[model samples]
Target: MNSDWQIELRALRYFICVAEEKSFTRAAGRLRIAQPALSRQIKKLEEDLRVQLFIRNSRGAELTEAGEILLRRAYLIFNQVQQTHHDVTIHSRHLGGVVSVGMPPTPGEFIAPRLLERSKERYPDIELRFVEGFSGELERKLANNEIGVAVMHDPAPRDDIRISKLLVEHLCLVGRSGTLAKPEYSLAEAGSYPLVMPSRPNFLRILIDGHAERLDIPLNIVTRSDGIGHTKSLVKYGHGFTILTYGAVISEVQQGVLQAVPICNPEILWTLCVAMRTDQGRKRTLAVIEELIQEVVQELVAEGIWK
Candidate 1:
């Protein structure tokens, strides 16, 4: 238990290089230093931290659990330092850096392009990374810092996440164009149609089931899928009707390949939110991205694009 010790940033970087390359020779080549010197630096870093960072074998240098933890923290530290340097050296409107955001398929399709476009217009030098996933996958990425921000629908409450509700979106029935005789369906009437929807515990499935239970209606779900793309495709070929928000089907609807009609007699609504990990310090770039997301959502809602 070494309580008082100092580790240099250079040593951490050397360790990271070795861990990433997984070979002292390769790491030395990449760092443009002698292998012996890189080995010495990693050894010193381990001594200072009082833990074995790597397990060297014939294969290569493999990181121990301690090394893995240090690598993650080192990446954050270096990113923060880089961001600080950029913030201090660049103009306010010309902020340049990288941002990673995660979103579910529905909102992902809409927001990613718009966010990238707006980010490019305002911060020409900034790079945007967008990750598309389901609610569960995006939640895990956000918690692990794999993504800086996330947009989700019907997100479960978590103590470590701070969520901001961007809008309340109504659920609608998605079907192939000209397949349905009308543009609206009540909850009771929707029960009679063969429905293609996500399985239980998914946000949409949960909402629909809750309403069905409260209203004493039986849903005839013939097929189940977790992917938005598959659901849309199934509905497009007349496999079965699926439930979704207008934002989820805008592209297909406009192309006349699919038709989206609001469900009523008791409209079902799900809250769309942007969330971030509360355990970490907020970054300037993340703040800007969050604002951009909210702005884009508001603009789309106002223009009837995300209704």
Candidate 2:
């Protein structure tokens, strides 16, 4: 590649017009540029590339092979840039613009409970929408602007969105604070447990299943519901144990209702973050967002949830 290949779209367009018109006088008329300046820019473009892009004859100018090739690729690049601006403009203009929010299956799982609560409290008037999906789908929706924000596992955020670190969490093996002696737990050695985790086919469930397979143990679900309260209540009542994130059980942990045993083998460390729009908006928009995020982090920090 040429070192000076960082040419602008306008330059490519001027070249294309000159090539198509094949006449300095006529191309200038088509582009509304004075013939002399149009000639100078195209000349600079060719010089930067170290290639002659056109040949001048008695009648006009026509593109050489190099010019034709570059023109084709430039056309595609400019068209994509054009479409991106168009889409972003449309998103901000629509009334009651839809901001689809992605939810993790088990409500209040991970750092989700307080995050959701803070969002509602801070932006009570701002419309919020929710759709349940895994990290992968949520990333896609964020990229397409279908989902304005997502709460999920790390390493899935897109290039277009900004993320704020909230907590470092993991699935800890826990039972009602008192039952660590008899255990009767078989998979503890291989990182498996008869945990009341999200059901199969869900993202977290798939991750747990993979670990269990490697440990060569079966994960028997004593509680198969995707309700956060229900799963925590099950473990609190000593019906069974569950592997949940710090945010999922932080309150209970602090209250001594559910004590945690950090997973030793095949440990999982996950970071929770909040996703937000990158656009610089009026102070009103950012004020709400700032409070919402600050609340989640401060709440977790005050409770000593994240390490």
Highest TM-score among the candidates is held by which one?
1
Candidate 1: regions farther than 4 A off: 1-94
Best by lDDT: 1
The TM-score values for the models, in the order shown, are 0.71, 0.49
RMSD, every candidate, angstroms: 6.5, 17.2
lDDT of 1 by residue, 1-307 (tens): 3788765889877987898789999999989999999999988888888899999999999999999988878867766676577657656555667777888877887788899999999878878877788787788767766678899887888998889999998888888998778768998887788999888678778889999999999999999998888889999998999888888899998999998888998899989999987854446677788999999999988888887
Per-model lDDT: 0.84, 0.64
Task: Please provide the root mean square deviation of candidate 1 (C-alpha atoms, Å).
Answer: 6.5
